[model samples]
Each structure stands twice: as structure tokens, then as C-alpha cells.
Target: MIEEPPTTTQRSAEVERRRAGELARPLTRPAGPIAVYDTVTDGMTGWQFLRTGRWLAYTAAAILFAIICLFLANWQFDRGQQASADNAVVAANFSAEPVPIELALPTLGSYDASQNWQRVSVTGVYLANEELVVRNRSNSGTNGFEVVTPLQLSDGSVFLVDRGWVQPSPTDALNPDSIPRPTSGTVSVVVQLRPSEAPLGTGSTTGNQIQSITLPRIQQTTGGDLYTGAYGLLNSQAPAAEAGLTNTQTSMPVEDVGTHISYMVQWLFFALLGFFALGLAARKVHRELNSDDPEERERASARMRKRARKPFTDEELEDEEIDGFLPLTRWGLSSGTGTGSVAGKTVGPTAAPRVVSPAAPRMALKQDDDAGDREQGD
Candidate 1:
């Protein structure tokens, strides 16, 4: 008894099974400096990705990171602009005519650049015991301290006054000789109105030395109805000792525009990088799903896998050969054959047999006759 060749249907089914098996095999890529194309192409394609919740999560995360970076960049830019404006205000009002303290002070939150470093006059009794020493203050490149004493105004409200810089004694103690003593009675004082300092959560709490002079913190610590702004004493009406004490040093806002600009550029770069990478991945998936040629898709996938391998080290380059790292070839795949069959019809490279036209045979015969005639003529 003889057995018949497998029918076309059976062959098709077998091919489908082989193709499915090949696809089901896991692809493993090593960790290293993988190419962007490899990173994009090595994942699930098209609808497979769209149908999964993981892909949505990944896309959302990328977008969120880009937005956060952009927000930080904008914040830095705004801060730079604010600094420039503050510097301008300091320059314009540093030596201007004195204004009344009430005219500069706002009824609400805090005084801004409009009042910062502006000279003002006020009559008050200095609260000697409630003074705070600003630690680690430097003047003329020498480490010293600034005494912040509160002045009790006639209206019963208190104003924190940054008196002056003072040098410590030889024993590192608060030197009475360093600080100038305020007059015994209520007196008129000329002071430069300044913005409240930033609150400090850290630094020395020992003795009278405090890290910062924020008005709110002072109000809380010293139990006083304090003014929103601080005053840097310029001069006292009452006769004062000519000590080495200097008025509060007005600080210049840092005008480092280049640093903030660089940071903005960096954040923008990160946003662009994330967006383009995501687009590349989406494009790769679209191509893989829409392509009609299965063999081409497989080859592309294999190329991506090869590119995803770990980068070669100097030692590995010297000791190991990379020639043996080839992927499984097209020759062994179901779609590898020269003749591709569909619904019992053969197609592709070997689809049709080559047949010479009758006109070609007649032309060849005429050529032979012409050769014979030429031979006779010769």
C-alpha cells in the first residue's frame, strides 16, 4: 500500500503551527547601552500594546515627567526675573530720601522691593533683653554677628531692628565692647527698612544667636506684636559711641542668569528626549503590525534583538569572538521557502514556470537560417 502526499490544507495548517511556535519562543535581550531603535522595536506591536493597561501607564508616566520638568524650568525662569527686579529696586532706592515707616509698610502680608533697603525714621524705646544675635554674619571679610533688637513703638507695636555687626570677645563670648549701647530713653532712629528674612529651621539655638531674623518666627519666639518688615539701623539721634559697629549690610541679589538659563535648557532637553523616544516606539509598533510580509517583520525583530545585546567591554573584545552571535536564520523559518503557497496556489520566487514565447522560437530559427545563408555567401 502507498501513501498520498499531504493535501494543501494540511500543509497550510502545519505552516501556521510552526509560525505560531516560532513566535511564542521568548526573546531575551541583555542590559547595556541599547540603541533607541532596538529599544523601540523589541516590544509588543500595535493593538497588542494598545489593548494592555501597562502601555497606558507607561505613556502617562512619560508625559507626567515631561510636565514636571517643564514646570521646574518655568519656576527657575520666574525666580531669575524676580531677582533682577529686586536688584533694580535696591539700586534705585539705596540712597534716596527717607520715607515714613508707615508709608513703606503694607497693612497685609509683607513688604516687597518697594520698601526693601529704603531709609525710614521712627521714635521707639529699644527692648534690650529681647534682642536676637544673627549668627555667622560677616563684615569686611571678618566673621562677626548682627544684633536684632526689637523697638517698642508708641502705638504699643514692636519693630525688629538689625542694629549692627559686632566682633566677639577674645573668649568667643558676646563682647559688650563690640556692641554700641542704645540711649537710655525713647529716641528717634534712622533705619533702612528691609524685607523679612527667610525662616530658618536649622542652626545654633544656644545663647542669643539665631540663624535667621524672620518676623513671624521672632513674633512666636519673643511673644511680641511685631511689624511685618525689619529695620537696619542707619543712625541714632541720641549721641552714640563710635564703635566698630556697622549698619546692616544690604545684600545684592545673585544675578547669575546663565546658571538658570542652563537649567531651563536641560529640562527642555529632557522633555524633548522623552517625547521623541515615545514617538519612535509607537512608530515601530505601527510598522510591525501593519506590514504584510511576515518574514520581513521577523527579520526586523531579530535585528532589534541583536542591537539590544550588552555592549562589548575591552576584555570581552580581546577574549571573546562576536562572530557566533547570529540570530536564527530565515532559511529555517516557515516563511523562508522560495515558493509561498496560499489557498493551494503557489506564489513568490518560484510561483510560475518560465516559458519561451512562440515568437522567440521563430526568431531563433530565423537567426539560424541567416547564419547558414551567411556561411554559403562566404
Candidate 2:
């Protein structure tokens, strides 16, 4: 007579006992292409893992990436430092009490970059005929020209002054509709110090229109003792220019430290993420190789099979040896050999034992068996 199949409850109880037995037994070196288990069994150390060529390549790539990130971080840090220095200079000079031009300059054509925007008082008469228009200037978003008048001091040296910006004539964009004349007599003017700009080499000066406040170039026309190093942005005059002109208001320098710090931090985190990803991948391989679960072991085996299809490198060959060997008992019904028995009970070729909790009561087991048998009959 044909023997009845074992009930689901009985199959489950058998699987639990087998799982417990497998867990209790000491792991032995597995044979075949599976090298990871063999390596673990042989007590391979962490240093040995790093010594592998694949790991060495990964480490080198991470180091290179980290070095690039650090370089960019340093560049941003330097830019932030420079911006801070510029802001400091503006803050110290923009509103300080005015000093005499003689004291501030001491020598003609000598100026300090750090003295930018410093307030200076000077008494001089405007040489209106020698005045020039600085082309391509803007004020309140209107494209215009700045009126640069030569202020001849009592000592006979001339200092250039940028009176203010004025809109070009609606009829003639090349010139102003009208230029307001500076106050005629000895005029006391308060002005901010500014370094003279470099000459724009060719086609920069034409007739009375100039492209920049380059003093030496302007001195070519005016021809006297000229302050070549610096000029002035007019603040106020005792007897200001006739009603048509307004003082040019210079914008204050911003003191904000931009997003460089944030970008620096993001790059550092990216460098760290590369190492984290490597660690996670290594852990996944370790778990898959050592797992007692047959499905997990099959997945690891599948990886090895895929790798085998490629021309093997030394590292790949080592990995292949680690993942190829699996125990017949662990494969159970899936192995197709049908040789292993679980808890002294024979399992069929197509039937894999189901795992159940060890704490299941005998009464519950009997109830489940009855239910399964009825279902099988149905």
C-alpha cells in the first residue's frame, strides 16, 4: 500500500528540529568554487580583505575623490576670507571723519588700496574747461556719463573729481543734454578717495569723452602736476554745483559670507558616503555568503554563476571560490538528490519542510494536521 503524505503540521515540526540541529553544529569548510566560506573557516582577518586587489582599487578611487573634494573646499574657504577682508576695509573708511587731502595722500600720486572710500576735505577751484565726461556710467539703472572735473588746489596740483552721473541727451546719446557748471570760486569739497582705474588701451578716449578715470591718460590733456594714483567720488561741496547735479551715491560693500561653507560641507559628506556605500556592499556579501536560509544561499550562488560567465580576474576567481560550495543538507528538497531526512522523517522530492515556531503546542499541531488532511481531501 502507498504511504500517506506527512501532514503540514508534521512537516513544519520536522523543519524546526532540523533548523535547530543545523544552527547547533559547527560550520565546516565547504568545498568547490565558494571561497568566502572557506576564507571565514580559515580565519581570514580584516587586513587580508584590504590586501585584495579589488579592495585596493576601491580604496584608491575613494581617496582620489576625497582629495578633489578637499581642494574645492579649500578654494571656497579662501574666497570667503577675501570677501571678509574687503568688507572690513569698506566699513572702516566709508563713514570715518574727513581728513585733509594733504594728510591722507602726503605725497602726490600715492594712495593705499586699504584707504578706499576714505573721506577727505580739499579747497580748490574747478577747472571747468578741462572737464571730461566718463562714458558708460550708470545711476539708478539709467545709462549715463559721470562728470569728471579737475580741481586745481592752492598748491597748483590738480585732483580729479567725479561729480556725479547725468543722463545722456534724449536727442544725442553721445553727449549730455546739459552739464551743470561747478561753483565758480574757491570751493571746499568733501569727497571719498578712490584708486584710479587702468587705461583702456585703444579707442578709450575721444575728444572730451573718456572710458575710465585713468589719471595719466587724463593728464595728457590737462598737462599740469596731476595726482595719478587716485581720484575722488564727490560727497558734498560748500558751494555745490548749480541745481542740475546730484552727488553720486556709492553703494556699501556687502558683508555676507556666501554658500561656500554649505558647499564645502556637502562635498565632505559625499566623500564619506563613498566609504559608507563600500562598507554596506561588503556587509551584504558577507551576510549572503553565511546565511543558513537556502533562498539566500541560492542568491549568493546565482551571483557566482553570473560572475563565472565573465573572463575571471584573480579577485573574481577568489570570489567565485567563496560562493560556489553549498551543503547538500542545506539545499534539502531543492537539491533534487532526495537523500537527507529531517528529524528521522522522510521528505518527498518536491516537498520543502516549512519552519514553525518551536513553542507550538501538540494540541495545536494535531488540530492543524486534521485541518490540512481535510483540505487535501477536498
TM-score, each model?
0.51, 0.60
> In candidate 2, how many Å is residue 297 off?
5.9
Candidate 1 stretches greater than 4 Å from native: 1-58, 106-113, 123-132, 136-143, 150-159, 173-177, 183-189, 197-228, 233-241, 255-258, 279-378
Candidate 2 residues 1-378, lDDT tens each?
667866768666664554333322222433222435555324543335555677788888888888888888788787778778888998999999999999999887789989989999999999998888888787778888899999999999999998988888999898876888888989999999999898763664567898888888778767889998889999888975677765677577676767766776877788788788877866665554445546555565555345423443566435434443222334332233222334343444322232223334343345446866799899
Q: How many steric overlaps does candidate 1 have? A: 0
> Candidate 2 regions off by >4 Å?
1-55, 199-205, 220-222, 266-378
lDDT of 2: 0.69
Best by lDDT: 2
Can you write out model 1's per-residue Cα lDDT over 1-378, one digit (the tens) per residue? Answer: 545745657544543433223222223432112224434334544456555566687688789989998998898888778777777777777667777666766452457767677777777898887777787777778777888777888888787777788876778654333576655678677777767779765744687778877777777777756886565555545545346677655554346667777888888889888888887876666665545446655565455345424354555433323221112222122223243323233233321111112223333333434765799789
Clashing pairs in 1: none
Least lDDT summed over 10 consecutive residues: which range in candidate 1? 350-359
Residue 334's lDDT within candidate 2 is 29
